[model samples]
Target: MRMVTKKQVPPLLLALGASVLALVFLLAFQGWIAHGADIFLSLAQAGLSWCF
Candidate 1:
């Protein structure tokens, strides 16, 4: 009788999948990320009383 073996995911493949998911998330939120950074910079400038 032949035994059925479960296939395991390779570590490299797992890492690659995680990286791809991260990239997808970053691309999807690109606009929001830019907006957040802009807001943060504006607040920092205000705190420093920079009028430029």
Candidate 2:
């Protein structure tokens, strides 16, 4: 098996950032989102917070 490398981190960070940003903007501007968007963002924010 191959080992994981630091190069993989940037993309995951970008994806997480985008998800968090979109969630924030949606909440502030649109006021609400569909089921999947809401759940996904909640999970992402929890993970990001946990990491930090």
RMSD of each: 7.8, 13.5
Residues 13-42, candidate 1: write the lDDT tens digits. 999999999999988799667686676687
Regions of candidate 1 where Cα sits further than 4 Å from its true position = 33-52
* Model 2 lDDT per residue over 2-52, tens place: 997665557789999999999999786665444556766787877853442
Residue pairs whose backbone atoms clash in candidate 1: none
| Per-model TM values vs. the true structure | 0.55, 0.39
* Worst window of 10 by summed lDDT in candidate 1: 43-52
For all candidates, the clash counts are: 0, 0
Predictions in order: lDDT: 0.82, 0.72
